[model samples]
Target: MRRLGVWIRAKITLSVLFSLMVFFIFLVTVVITGVLFFLAHFFGLINDEIAKGGIVLPIIILISCILIGTTISGFASRRMVKSIREFIEATKQLAAGDFSTRLYLKSPPEYRILSENFNRMAEELGGIEILRTDFVNNFSHEFKTPIVSIKGFAEILKHDDLSREERDEYLDIVIEESARLASLASNVLELSKIETQTILTDKQMVNVGEQIRQCVLLLAAKIEKKHLDLELNLYDYSLSGSKELLNQVWLNLLDNAIKFTPEHGTITIEMKRPAGLLEMVFRNTGSGIDPEAVPRIFDKFYQADTSHSAAGNGLGLTIVQQIVSLHGGTIVCESEPDQSEPDQATAFIITLPSETSK
Candidate 1:
């Protein structure tokens, strides 16, 4: 047998029709019939008048019930109509880039829930708009800086009487600027790819500790340049996840730690499984991040060190946070300022549920 389906509009209409039928056809008919019979008995016309006016009484009652039911249904359905019209208007405004528009529904519980959800969606859209604007502005500025440097140095290298040292220095400056531009482009592309990925497709049993160790070793040159003391206390723990994505997380965190750690500072990488959760911490001793800047550190294009002296596009931590979220995990940062010891540390602590945990 073939099955049929009623859509939302048809269902709503059918519901209103059913309600009207119950009130007007069934309940109204029964009440009016009882009233007419009582009146016939009260006026001492039960036998003769009942037999003569039985059909007439029912016709009059049915007409009256239809009129009353139409009036009440009109009022109730009008509210529904008004709510739907308002919802359509709000959606149009949203489509036109008006994120501030919201629906104030005072009609029914279901409509109220829909309005609340619409408002929440509007809020998220507004936030994304802000991020987009910031990205465009910041990207332009970042790209412009390297171009300016390359142009200025290339002009200087045109001098015929320049010394070898001066020529080499200008060439080095151009090279560094070009590398910076390339890095920025790569980071932007990576972020765009990750944002569109809705699921972690490549799952594997990865050695969490070994992956982190490799990330740290990859940045050994930078660590040596800073003369930083490296401490590693990794526990043997494996987890089922996307190794490629998690590797990016560790590399970004370690790179940030190396970038911010002062000369001759201390850096620590610790991993442990506690209560069926894999917790990894990367801590570096240096000028700690401010408490106010902690909340927005994971925001795209957000840099706590805003001096532009840092070798970053402000997307590393943002990528780290996104990758962690994809794994159904959490990442947090904590810092303590130095009073006298000068051993203050800033830490990025990541917690993930271990699949191997019994």
Candidate 2:
């Protein structure tokens, strides 16, 4: 609450101080001029002709007051607008893609607050610019890698002397790369669409637990192949959101869990309503994410522990976060490199409001 009023208080304080200073300056000038006149009269220094007819002293005193006031006002105005000019130039630099620009205002509490806010904004913009550049560079590399692989393998397959098994393996490689490229393109388009959606549409009262189980069934083949021990600690929790979108969230999370989980590892899906908000946790004994990388795991094209996670295009979590946001929920990755225990390993926790309609 105090923060809410800080800017208002600052503006009022500044205006009142400026008004008081101006009044005090003129009052001082008048007081000094009156004292001079009184001294002259007491000393009999002003002749009767000068006092009654000339009016020279009074005019000169008035002119002196104007000059003093004008000089002080002009100097103060220039000082004040110096900050404004700095602000304008900073803004120009910011618009020119210089997210490093900052402001440092000392006087006028409002501009100080503005300076702080501007620095914070610049910092955030700088981080975003870095992310954007990384995304483009990563996108180009990811896009080109599969194409090069496909072309090279196709050329290998074109050799007539190749054995049947060799030709079939090359063809499989080509098909896999094509599928990967298709998935990447589809995810990019989906993320673009989801990012532009301000409000959730096609909402229905979805059975959250049932939806998760269905997603598990979709990836049952992968789980079986990995020999993963799957656990379900879910309850009947309904949610009001797009069922299809939420399905994507679980499928991607489970796919990642399966992709990284070693043979005979555990995968657990638990949904619980504690404090009235449903907390759906998907945990797997997969590769642990570095603590520093956890915060940026959702960023587009950010893959943590790339050595263990090279196969992914890194858009899954980004899409999951966007869809979760559309549903007015939050999703987080709570995995640390130190937490390598099977049950206490990497986990994705999604929290959402339970449906009142249920």
Candidate 3:
């Protein structure tokens, strides 16, 4: 449970031992010299000249040993103290919201490990800090949109000169804007709960085909409105996960496809067995994700393009990824701009363990 560096501990131990050894050696030498001096005086072998010369030798040896021991102990203690102080300061900076701070102590292996762990901690903190900042900015903008729309429509409704039809239209706009705001808030809350592990799922073996059909039915209106083609190649695949959560996952993915795909564009859902795993591939002929943004596509509040800001608050993919991970699965994206074939198109491939059905 003691997480301090090994080198510092070793250094302290060695310093103490060295000091004790010097003391022991000095003590033994004094005892032997005292016995010899006493015997010499009693035997009349310590005359004035002999006594003077012998006294100076013992004094010189004792002084030299004391000076050497003190100097070595002081140097060793100073080095250990400096390393510990640096480590403490680095941790304090990290606690104070400075995630970039790191301990540069390179004295011993233990210090090295401590520094490495500190760096890892700092990196994690920095990542979370960035995510929090982005979430706040995105949340504000998402809320602002609906509020602006509602305010504009409400002001129009306040006009006594407006016709009945205009007033009804304004009211409808207000309602729609309110619904948008509610939806944004709901999604944000769900994402937070999922990320914080507050939302538990009752996972069970589920038919992927049925789930896809249900999601498709939910988005039937959007698909028809956009005039997009739906192609299904499901193979009665079953996945072990929360049915409700997985249903949401499919809905978000397909919904995103419908939202981005142009009229006459095609959205395909394919399930296949590959390498003892159940794989679901959702490909859409929508605007391809930017290569630069592909790495962070699943990151919360990340959008490929700012123009699509009106479409979503960008937490949909983040939620989808979390749900998949909860099911012990992985999701990957393959996309290229304006590609001809389905494989070349923007595709999301999700792989789940096939054993979930058992």
Q: How well is each residue in 4-80 modelled by candidate 1, as lDDT tens digits?
A: 33343334444565576456555655676678667866888666664577597667556766776666667656756
For candidate 3, give the lDDT of residue 319.
95
Worst 10 residues of 1 by lDDT: 1-10
Model 3 vs truth, CA RMSD: 6.9
Structural similarity to truth (TM-score) of each candidate: 0.80, 0.83, 0.79
Error of 1 at 209 (Å): 1.9
Alpha-carbon RMSD to native, per candidate: 8.0, 4.8, 6.9
**Residue 160 in model 2: lDDT:** 92
For model 1, which pairs clash? none
- What order do you get sorting by lDDT, best first? 2, 1, 3
Summed over model 3, clashes come to 0
> For residues 124-211, what per-residue lDDT tens digits would candidate 2 score against the true structure?
9999998789989989988998999999998898789999999999999899999999999999999999999998869888988888
The better candidate by lDDT, 1 or 2, is: 2
Off by over 4 Å in 2: 1-12, 28-68, 308-310, 336-341, 355-358
Residue 21 lDDT, candidate 3, scale 0-100: 57
What's the lDDT of the predicted structure labeled candidate 1?
0.83
